[model samples]
Target chain A: MFLQKKFKEYYSRAEIGMPRRFTRREYGFMFFERQMMLRHISFSSSQKLRNFLTEKAPAHVFYSSAYYSKPYEKEMKDKEWLGADLIFDLDADHLALPENCTYERMLGIVKNETKKLLDDFLIRDFGFDDLEVVFSGSRGYHIHIYDREVLELGSRERREIVDYVTGNGVSIELMLGKDNYAVPSVSEPGWYGRIGRAIGSYTDRILSMDDEERKKELKNVKGVGDVRAERIYEGLKRLKKEPRAVNALPKEFIEHLKDRVAIESSRGEADEPVTSDIHRLIRLPTSLHGKTGFLVKPLTLEEFDDFDPLQDAVVFGDEKVSVNVLKPFSIRIKDFSCNAEEGIVEMPEYAAVFACARGFCAEE
Target chain B: MQPTILAKYPFLPEAFDLVKDESMDEILHSPAFNRARELGVARVQRALKNEDSFLFIDERNCFDVVLSFFISKAIVSQMNDSFLLRRHAIFEAKNAYHYLEEESRETADAVARSLGIKRDRNGVSFVTFLKYSPNAYGQWKLANSRLSGGMVEVDDHTFLRLVQEAVRERVEGIKFSVDGLEKTLDLGPIRAELANRKVTHRADRVELESFPPCMKSIMAQIENSINVPHQGRFSLVAFLNGIGMKEEDIMKIMAPIPDFDDRMTRYQVEHITGKEYSTPSCDTMRTYSLCFEPDGLCARIKHPMQYYEYRLHVSSKKV
Candidate 1:
């Protein structure tokens, strides 16, 4: 009851950012207690959306990235889709991190993945500029491209984009050549260029390792015995210059290294389904996540480098609140740090809301 | 535009503009169009049979070529068979591609421009490339192809292939208002050609194991009494119907769900099956976000029915 009131109070005061073409997008809301979403709701203006947010105080708010001719239509077909902003969702849940990684570490890793997606794939490769990056408020980040060129892409084309970023169908033979030994210049475009650089870095890493480490790495590569590994190590610099120069070594060894570079050169690992789904409802910017009570905060590309979510996303003020912590938990939000075992505790209102929202604690 | 080129590529918008003034009455009943009608039937028959015989086109018979092309489209439109329409489109596009291969680069570029293929300094627009890249060879995917400066680079052949796809889409969308024209023309031969074109599914047995990964995932959810989404339910019902499953048997499969209202379920099943709603294509499934856990075979086929049939064929062949 306290958290819901606080959320309502926050919504009433907060000047939430409206998505572009506010009237054309469909809005969806999940209330405080309900898991089911009430969607197909359209707002004509910012004030209408603000009024609904203040009145109902939805736990989570979402708006369609797709523009619809009939935004309030009940049936999918009736809602004539005009176009959609291309979205790339980089969530921690999609990453294959260690089982016991800290929350902070997971965020940091996902943040790096998000950067690679934005900088390497979207910006450098795809040449998309009109981008909006938002902290998803719970697990990861969402990068939305509002470039006019990408707006009208169908799901098949979007799927092709997904395949490109995630390196789904990159053929090593094509990258190298028909003979599997045709060394490509590093200036080659796209995956070919990336894999070429990756080979150079792989060789550099192998040469920098101490004798035992270098030997261990080479021996681990299939069909590379101690003798072949020694020869390959001797010509490592040459192999870096010309990937095809290592053919004198075991073919399996060169093939293995090529395979390694192919995997390493894959651009980004954004969630596939999210990118491919043209009518996906992305989290509304500045809305509080139902699970974490943190703001789905939008950031400028410049602010993204220095922004810390735990501090900046914590919107609630620091009033003291009492809550029964169900388990031992340690969290840092804003300037307040809480390290408490299972018991009734007094903490800042923000921490209390965060804990209670995540089901880690309950109001006393 | 040259009339000869227009006749060769009659599906072009310019060709349509020229023919827009011709009356439907002249097209249907004019004894002067007897050669056009004959050639139209031959065009559709060749498409149905997948033959490589060319429509005789020359400077002298350019008018006949243009008229025959429009007459063939009108016949297909009157038939109202999507499958036949698609086959005709592919066949026409393939023919155009073969001709484009022999044509000069300037002519090809002109045709591309006519089809709205935007090209800048980099290459063709990424939108155009992606729009037509589906069902193309593996190397044609953006992941494998050369893309730079926000455009897809293509050589003369690949560019023509893309044009072919554009032409296919244009042909597929060709709907002529021939409601009365169908009564004027004797359409017995064309009707006979369409009788065997409807896809018939093998009804030997329900091979549960042969279900595509998407269907299998939905079946698993249903068997575990997990609530499947509306898209998943529709795809599952359509797929089961496509595989010749009886209404009662499909109902038994849905019985495990907690909220499975028998009457509502049966009604939906009948509506989907009794109406003969074929399985949603793989692309449609992907668009609706129902495609789950696509596997190796998924990449090779375009539809779930094709997946099941291919799997069944392979397994049966091995046995």
Candidate 2:
């Protein structure tokens, strides 16, 4: 009763109207409150949507993928889907970070990767004018592309986009010159461009370094042997000094150089399955996450760098609440860290919300 | 409170001349008002203005006009963020005409039917809008043969103009005859061009020179009674099925096997025929060590199916 009243009161303070869906059947999940099941629901207006949210008080508000012509229709297949947004889910779990890594570290990695995706791939490669980035609230980030040009892309095309973003299926043969002996420049489309740019930068980086550093860097390149490394240094110098450029290297030597570049350059790690899905329900921004008493926040790319989920995403203020804690917990939530023993804890309302939401404590 | 008409909702131009004109007939005829705008709203506006369901005497001209509007207004908002030109592509048309892969097939059909235009399932399709969106947000669009072998991102208005221009270019296709028979095209040049094109087919199996290099090599190996690998056998079966070869003929090709099992071979061939197992992709073939770089015919294409298609396309066989 208290949770419902509190949740409703908090929700009524909305300055802006409820975010409209392409379909009125708003999807949400409140897993810990009950057995979580994803089902379509209709709400006519913002008031009705608010009613559903507060009454159900779902831990998570998920936006459905199906934006139907007849949104009120019950069944998904029966509802004629007009179209949906192209969403890219970037999760912390997808990153190459160490196991048992902290949330902050994982978020940092996600930020770096997502920034690269936005700068290099989305805007530069695909040429999308409008790209939306949002925090997943729990794990990583979500990138939404709203361009009509891609509305009709089927599973095959979506898969190709994933392959491109992840740098998968990039061939070495395609990157190397066949008729003309020049590596495809950075201006080329897709991986050939990426590999070319990587090699150019790598060459510059190695040449700028001392002889020992140069040897170390070349050795680290996956396929470069000592002799090949020496040859590459020689070849790179000739590339810099001579008009013959990189063409002076033998075909076998070029092959090895290309392989080394491919190995060194390949590092696109987006969650593959998410981008390919045409109809995917994503967690709604600004909705409270039941798992951690934190708001599932949405941020622009500019706002993302300064915003920290642990501090900035908390909704509740500093009113204290007493709860019988089940387990000892040490978590940072907006400077009010809950380093409580396995007993009763008289902590702030923010921590209490997290503790109660996580089923870590019972409000007494 | 009255609802506000969202400015630039579809086509960015909020006030078109048709909407501004006080005279009813002038608005109805529309005086070729930015015929490039192809605003689907123009169709509704024209119908409302003309007070008739059909706009032009020739439905292709009308379709071209209406298709522009549907793209400009119905499909995308001029705010530069609506459905990609591929949003709910709904219809696909593929025949001979370059640039157009598909358009709003069902919508066009309904519009055509209403306007007394005959819609052919195949043949005689020109100035098509081919839009294939293959993933969640990745797509290929060819609406109106105006892309000049390249693609461009378009707002509703731009898309409308491009499609209208294409329709105008192929306006001769819009026959004015009573039954469309009198004004129908000769298609003699097109037919001659097709006849002169080199084509490989399952039906034309007797022409050994028309065979793709991979298939030809596989056949040679089969004839020499050399042991073919599992991957080679699979590729052969898939290739045969694709070319519409019969079960007996397919088995005959495989009969030269040193340790041939009749039941096993028959079942595999039957499976390929039934589409129980699809042909492996070029990548999968490479993984199986069955893919070989064959000279000629195979240079540009990746798959055996593509190679066969390429061969048939280049083949100068007559209809």
Candidate 3:
């Protein structure tokens, strides 16, 4: 109940602007006490949206990436899909991080991944310029692309885009020259060039290591034995200098290296199902996340480079509040870091809201 | 464009416009259109026979070629068989590609643009490539193809191939009214040929090991007495009947369902076979979300029967 009041207060003060074609988008909400979502709703103007926000104070807000001819229709076929903005969601939960990874560290890792997706794939390769990035209010980032060419793509075509970024089905044997001996040229386009460059860097990394480490690394590759590793180590310099020397190593070694290079050169790990789903509803930017009380903030590419969610997304002011800490928890927000144990503690309003909402502490 | 070129490529918009206002009665029964009518029947027969022979184009015969193409379309609409429609579309598109290879780049580009393929300063848009890439091989997939500045960079040959794909889809969707055709030409021989093609028996030896993964999964579900969804049950029954399973055998295979009634199951099985319904294509199965656990072979073929046929051929080659 207190969280709902605080959320309502935030909505009252915040100047939340509307998304593009806001009236055409299907909006969905989950109120503070309700578990089921009230979806397929539309707004006519920013004032109407604001009035609803201030009055209802929904705990979670979402809008569809797709535009429809009839947004109010309950049935999918009746909706008559016009087009959709391509969406790529990169969540830290989907990444293969260490078990004890901290939230801050996880965000940092996902930030780099999102950067690679933006610069390497979307910008450099696909040439998509009309894209926006949002801090997902927790755990990750979302990239929304409003490019005209990608608007009417169906699910299979969208999956092909996913396959390209993820480097699915890239075959090393196909990249070989006529003799099947020479490696792909660095000047080649698409995955060929990317994989070729990755191979060069991986060779350099292997050569920079000490003798024992080098042999261990070579043998660590799946199809390479000790003898094959020794042969590869001897031929490493030749392989780096002359691309055709790739065939000097065991065939299995080159095949395995190609698979590794394909992985290393892939754009980034994007959540596949999200991009393929045309009717996906994403978290509305500038809305406060119910669980963490952090704003789902939008950022420019420059602002996103240095943005810290724990500090920047804290919307509440520094009014002091008393909270009963039911469990030990640590949080750092707005220069106030709490390493509270199970006891009563005085904290600022933002910290109190974050704690109570997270179920670590409660208002006294 | 010259009439001679339009005659060669009757699938083009100019050809359609030229023949659009012509009287169907004259085209079907007029002494002036006797040669056109014969050529049109020959075109449909060639497609039904799965032969991709091209019709010769001459400046003198421009009108006949344009009229014949639409007449062939009318015959296709009169028959109204999905399999024959697909075969005819593919045959015509292949023949178009053969002619397109020798045409000037400007002519080919215009045809492609008319079919909704956009080409700006930056090669063809990725949207065009993706929309037409489904039936293409893996190498032609958007992932494998080269893209720059939001466009797919293609050589002239690849561009026409993309145009060929577009033409196939366009022609496959073309339907003409044959409301008054019964009073005109006798289409009995063509109808008999289609019926004969339909009843050509499969090998008595069924290859259970060669079934597509979707059908295999549905079979497993039914054998375990699990309640398969309506789409799954329909696809499974259609596929089994398509692969030459006996009606009684299909009923036996379906008997393990929890709600199976002997008479009802037999009737439904007979209905599928009696209607001669071909198994739904892979795309349709995917739209219904019934394509489950696709194997490597599934990626190469567009239909369930193709999967079975390819597997059967491979196993026979091994023997």
Candidate 4:
């Protein structure tokens, strides 16, 4: 139920429009996994439990999972040795913990003990909006703030960010010190508007749903808020209907619409009978056989090239046949070119039909 | 023996024959010979004036050939088989003048102190020369263990002045003073007897089987003061100064063979202390010593052979 609520919330907030469909199975799985991952209350679950986070409070999180396993062992030995809470197929060479503790009672004793550092130092210096948190699902949380504006930043810049946040010359243990979580202020340009735009776009999707969908989705999606669902629904609706109006749309949207139309049309025609074109006639090449010529009904290019009408039929008098009163058909008297060059001759079925329906061809 | 002719004039044997008709004494005292001596002296004086531009003085050819024979032999004798000096030439008579001047100053102060002479002026002249000279090729060879020709030259007077200043500073700046101190200190006769008497029964015992009482107390103090354990049971010398007893003395007393010859093992040190002594590995010791020397005193014991080699190697190749 929690997963279903989460999925509905996600659906309401998501910006996909134009009758984009989801299988019931996929929706159910996503909801179930998210709920199970966030079941435990710890600093690492901050991302999972972000809906319950209070405004402006700082929190530290760590991401951890068991890295390896053997058939004999239920869990990895190193994971157990390190007291890891979850196991995953990822490297766990280094263990990290966050400096600040937020929402002490729910997170755990470790977080409660580390809360003062978050409140006194990090919160005091770095404003509440400067802090962002993500759940790592297993042992830790990833904390990020979209506030750096370095252009074309590379891997080195990421390391520089780590160094700046941790403070120069500060050891990992010192950065995660129980007494202090506040890092010194690093003078750097702030984050670009591009990052804010991305966040704004996602937030809009989550908040676009109408009231009925929003309420239903919110109940299912644990973290989805009403505002996000409304935004998402509105965005989706705008995306779906706006291009059909007089206004021009982006090429991508046009393509998306075309694909949607094709899918719908194909579904509508599923029960129709299959038929070949009657007006179109395909020509084929000649075929031959030893001591006799045999005419073959051509099906494809290869058969058409192999069939030789002149060689397959013996030369004889020409005749005319009529298929209907308005249409007449002509044929030449011919003998069978196969079977020891026997003189047995036959005309095509079209000629016979023409003779029955109308008069014969006129002599010329 | 016939009067020895110092100027054989080997390159011009005929010149010597033409000049040899006169008595040896007459030639030796002749104005011509005196003129030659004056020419030699002038040549040396001119070189000394331009010594700053020369790498060496050919004392053998320049001084010995025409200058007074007595001065050349004196300079040559002082230089014996010291290979570094053998490769360089000296201004024998000129250097003798300087050496005598230095000796006179030393004698003057000694006489003044002994006889209580209150002369206002000591009349001692300090001669200074400005010159550039190369170190001998052999000196370079000794330093690098390879033959090389490039040598550093310095103004001898300036070098001596720097040396004097450095010595004065070092002597003045040293914190510990051994002045007026007696050479010997009394130790209990029991310890002396233990050191002198040959104890044959303990020959098979390990060198660090036990520590002296004084060393044991010092080890305990070190252990308590620093959280780290002592490296090993040590001698009284190590306990006092954090260095082992001098190797030469150990060899003289104990006559330890191939195994214990002045180099004590970690196990042996631990055996003596009756305590677990955990010494950092040699590499760790080196790293810690380099990092923490200015901040903290390193408490690692070094092998005497290693210490001696370091000192010898550094001194021989000192920049």
Candidate 5:
């Protein structure tokens, strides 16, 4: 009753912005009559919307990209809609990082890649200075670009932008200067500049890795021996920390170097389907996570690395509640970390909320 | 506002505005712009800065990327700043000139005449003004543009200079940037219209409602277990697979083919499903005569996947 009251009270006062207005709204129930779980969906008013959230307090909330005139109509065509935001979600699973990486490492890789996406492609190249970057509060990040310019872009144009971000179409020919054979200047625009930076980072990562593995990977770069790998590694390391003339590296070396840089350049990965999907529905920010018992709150790019969702995102306070953990397991929720066999446990306010949210435990 | 006529006389305000205009320069210089197959703004810049450097013609797409963006920007305000005439042909030009009374024939003539392009006696050249052409060239050009061009007969920098010189000769670059041609454009509304408009993506499953004519024909053939040619089968499977159809679904689609070689068909379909090979592209489909009948939208799209995406886009916008 207390948890139910907490949810009802929160919704009664929680006035947050919806991503899109006049959406094809649907609320899914947790464990009630499956037949009536998502029926009579509507976009009537905040009161109606809030009522669904509290009365049923559905397990999931979904809103469409469309802004319909009469969203409750039986036929989809009846709803006269306005516009939708261009949202991109980058998840850890989508990225092809080193295989068998841990969840924490996956999140780390995704965060770095997301940062590069915002800084390099979105801001510097595409000229979107300000963007809505949201921590998915899970294993990925969501980038919502709300500029009018983006909305005008068609599917193909959007795909091309995705292509640029993912380094799919970037070519070495574009980077290498014409006629007078020269190593690519870092000052050149577009993919050339991006590749230069990627090289530095890739080299730093390579140097930090085990030398034996590095040598093997380097050998595969051109079938070069360990001597060449050691030489190339050192040269790349020196090149990373400073800039010199364009022809500083050997032509043969730069030729081989370009291929490696291309691979490194492709590290700017994103889920292509998500970015290109025009009518995608995303998790609503500030809504309590159904799985984590934490709020799906928005975070600034500055706070991206430091923000800890497990601890900082907890909404329920220190009030203790009993929950029956079905299976034997343990979990950490803020200061309350509990290990218990398959039975009931008195979890703190946050732990109980999280356990209940995940369906790992139910309130007793 | 049309800069074609003014392109000839260097001193003409329109000519300077057309070629040397900073907006033109920006678009031309943008990484997206492609003049031809390999010669783009970047490659041209590299060539120009280095006097002895020769521009390499790396063949890719055959259309100008910069022009496509220009057309989209131009239609809202100046309608004839640049010509999108097909085949440099005069009949199409005449047709386009006659269709839109508000559009200027003189402006079209001026651009063609100034560029030394010849016209037939009908006062039309194969080249006429188009927002976006209906031909295959125009379709891929628009879809893949904002890239580089193919090999030009003349030197890269010289041709670029001519195009640039036309825009920059007399117009103040900065002034042209501010008040030249785009004075009337409010992209916000354009964006809103686009957002409200339906769009497509890499669909997980095909929507039968949006199937292009060619695919429909192929499906009809397949449904009856008719013998579709190798090209037809390739096109069919690729189109089906591109839209997220499963291997089993594709096999079912292929079941009606004359030979009904399950193993062979499975191999081909799996090739695409596994991403070992991609679906036949727009050009390949056209080459095999497997291209479906024109449905008006065919002019705007190139590949079957593109058609599927466009269908989803259209449906999404349906209200």
Candidate 6:
């Protein structure tokens, strides 16, 4: 009887204030719609009263006046802990009431105004065909999407969708009407279309092909030599288009192509191998079997000059010999038939021992 | 008149009483008084006759003479107490040693200066103490304060000689001698000598006997093991035949074998074989086999049965 009376009063108010285009049932409580309507009641009401209203006329409650109450204030402290689907706290201060109103009256007015604003915003901007609001037991109301698919989306992607709805910088136009904001179409070429859209199209094309065809095209494509680049291209293409009928290629071949493509692309135009004239001299240990340990004997200046009468040589310590005190006399002994082309140097064991000893002693 | 009578008459009761009271002289008979006066005059006459009469009158006993002698003669013996005797002697000895030490330091410094060797303060003291502090003998002379005759002293030379003997004995306890050995022989030269000696023994059958039987057997095993692979690959039967042992006999000698997996190549087998045998599987097999089981024949052989069993076990366990 009380619910019938309340409905009659709300109905009379709706008839006078709401547009006549809405159906009588739309303005009144349908069986499922009651849950959403009763949720707007002020929290100061007794639990018995709330239960009674909710049991018969279950309405979506929006708790928008948490600023005035200490309990509600404490509950909304950790915005993250609320697990709210959509938090509307950014511009909550604009919903505050005048000082003359009592707490319950102020809350009621704010709740009604906020609910109307939310309904209008959702319908006009986002075109949400179905939405339900619930009191957050704190500052803002939670807007839940009962659709499972929307909930199944990854957290990051869901955040992106939420950002788009909230009119973030890149997606602001999505929330505005055609008169207020215009989104550029992909059909006309712009900076985004040329670079971003073109890459996306190219990726779609590559991913649409079979593995064998893809490999052939990859192999034929010039400058696609490095593996990482090829893998990235393949990934972008796969993301853009559906899989083709071709079987999965062997991992080794795919990896090989990817590596090659990465290397080629990274190298760019400079493809030739580097060349140098400087040669490295590797000093090998003297060994008996190689004839590298017994051929050239280290001799003093006097001995060297006497042996080779054509040139005068002077010994400098143990390792060096100078001819005429200026130009040094150089000799390289070859091992195994004395072949200079082989770069084999033979040194007498006794001369090596003497040289090593003399080198160490001279350093000290 | 008599020496005994004179000694007793000095301490007599009647004389003591007469001295105590002037009226007591009337009690003394005239004869007694005359006798006493004569004795007294005689004593005075004796004193006037001798120039050394005071010395005789003040003569001391042996104990008093000894005490005075010790007090006057000894350097640090001022008190007669036996407890202080050792401490006084020690103090006097320390003082003497310190004086000698300082004097020696000065002398050493002068000598070093003359020789043109730099002498710092510490260096001078080090040399002085090094010389005067008993040398390495660990003995030194100390004064004896208890003696009454003269200043205490010790024979330092005799003490030093005894210390030297003790030290010599200790040194001799662990002495070693190498007779007829050249001190200048280099280890390198010894190695060269050994190499030359080894070459000489190569042809000597008697020298071969110097190697123990176990060493000879190991050498033979190593030689045979290496030679078998070089000769050619032998079948199970052929290998047994070459070794003059049947399969069962060979297995009996080397049984209760552990299984290996197929992944374990012949190189692994050869590795456990200590390079005594080589397998065609891989170059590292001999080395691997040597690491696990160097002594076993199975380490050298790649048993197909064991490999299969190991593989089966591994696959089952994995499953």
TM-score of chain B of 6: 0.13
Clashes of each: 0, 32, 0, 45, 33, 40
State TM-scores per candidate: 0.79, 0.58, 0.84, 0.15, 0.53, 0.14
Please identify model 5 stretches exceeding 4 Å from their true place.
A1-6, A20-44, A68-82, A96-107, A198-217, A222-260, A303-305, B1-319
lDDT of 3 by residue, A1-364 (tens): 7788999999999989588888888889998788999999888889989899999999899999989888878876677777788999999989989889998899899999999998878887788988899999889999999888788876556777887788765656656645666767766667777767777788899899998999888878887778888888877788888988877777777767766665655656778779977788999999988988999998888899899988888899898999899999998888898899998999999999999889898778
lDDT of 4 by residue, B1-319 (tens): 0112212111122223433354434323466455443443333333223231211223333322423222222222332312111111233223322332343444423322222222223211111000111110121111111101111122234333322322222222222212211122122332333334225223332233143223334345444543221122233223222223332332333222212312232222322222211222334334323112221112333432233234434555764
- What is the overall TM-score of model 4 with all chains considered together? 0.15
What lDDT tens digits, residue by residue, belong to model 6 across residues B1-319? 2222212222222223323343223312344344333333232223223211111111222222222112211211212222123222222233222322333444423322322323342222111222222211112111000001111112333323222222222222222222221221122332343356445433222222222222233334444543222112212222222222322343332222222112221322222121122122212233223222223433443542233234435555776
True contacts kept of 5: 0.00
Instruction: Residues B53-117, candidate 3: write the lDDT tens digits.
Output: 77677877888988888888888988887657766887788888888898887887777787898
lDDT of 5 by residue, A1-364 (tens): 4455555555566765566454444322342224343533664576776676767554445555434456565543454434456667888777788977865577678878888877766665555645687767567788877765455343334555566566553444445545653334455445655556555566677788797888877778655676767777777676665544334544566656555565455446667666655445566676655555566667777777686666767777787777788866667667877776778788787777666655677668
- Residues A75-160 of candidate 4 have per-residue lDDT tens digits of 22211121111111110112233454332222343222223223322233222233332222222222222222221222222222
Q: Is candidate 4 or 5 superior in DockQ?
A: 5
Q: For model 5, what is the error of residue A126's alpha carbon versus the real structure, in angstroms, after optimal superposition?
A: 2.0
Residue A328, candidate 4: alpha-carbon lDDT: 34
Model 6 CA deviation exceeding 4 Å by range: A1-113, A124-130, A137-140, A170-364, B1-319
Candidate 2 chain B has its poorest 10 consecutive residues by lDDT at B88-97
DockQ of each: 0.29, 0.04, 0.26, 0.01, 0.04, 0.00
| CAPRI verdict (incorrect, acceptable, medium, high) for model 2 | incorrect
TM-score of 3: 0.84
Q: Is the docking of candidate 5 incorrect, acceptable, medium or high quality?
A: incorrect
What is the lDDT of every predicted structure here?
0.80, 0.54, 0.81, 0.26, 0.52, 0.27
Better model by DockQ: candidate 5 vs candidate 6: 5
Q: What are the RMSDs of all candidates, in order?
A: 7.1, 15.5, 7.2, 38.7, 17.7, 54.1
User: In candidate 2, what are the lDDT values of residues A273-319, reduced to their tens digit?
Assistant: 57755556777766766667677777776787787877877777788
